[model samples]
Target: MKKEMYAFVVPCSARPLVFDESRCVGCNRCAEVCQVDILIPNPEKGRPPVVLYPGECYYCGSCVMACRQEGAIRLQHPLMNQAKFVPVRHAADAGEEKPLPAEKRRG
Candidate 1:
């Protein structure tokens, strides 16, 4: 009989959680607060928890919110999920004639 081994790998782009070791207190709050159970507490004391399944993250920011140390944990949304804003221009701003008011407008 032969023994079998397995390993799990995560792509860099799929990783959604970032831990700042310098700022992290290693309290394991992030692991405890993770809604998806992707984060695992490090067995070593005073070390940041490990991200077990980065691709499974929900980007809910619960881990970041639960961390007592500021800037310890940060949640990154995928590019497709990020919000984009474009400046809006009114008709007058674009040099277009404004439509006649149906009735006199009151302030």
Candidate 2:
């Protein structure tokens, strides 16, 4: 069965995301990883990822991690004004809600 997408709330007080189409490599890894279904893949065109619902973002940084590009995705925290280009692994590791990746075994 297909999972239902949610309208997750993204806290923009930290800062907002910067869209750089130039850095995007048309990878939909972010959309795949997003449980909330915030991002959608552009299949018709070059197949780049687009933020379908920014409000649904949990700010978990899963999208940033899924993005292979160095500066393709960024995380904007409430304490910071500009979104920082944090490594996906590091951001996933920082979150206590879930494990870094599905490949990583939890004991």
Q: lDDT scores for all predictions?
A: 0.80, 0.64
- Spell out the clash pairs found in candidate 1: none
Alpha-carbon runs more than 4 Å astray in model 1: 1-9, 97-107
Candidate 2 deviation (Cα RMSD): 15.0
Candidate 2 per-residue C-alpha lDDT over 3-37 given as tens digits, one digit per residue, 9 for 90 to 100: 98554344433343455677877767777998788
Least accurate 10 contiguous residues by lDDT in model 2: 7-16
Candidate closest to the true structure, highest TM-score: 1
Task: Name the 10 consecutive residues with the lowest summed lDDT in model 1.
Answer: 98-107
TM-scores for the candidates: 0.74, 0.52
The best candidate in terms of lDDT: 1
lDDT of 1 by residue, 1-107 (tens): 58796445455566698789899878999898888888777768888888878888878888888889999888889878789987865665677665776453333
User: Candidate 1 local accuracy as lDDT?
Assistant: 0.80
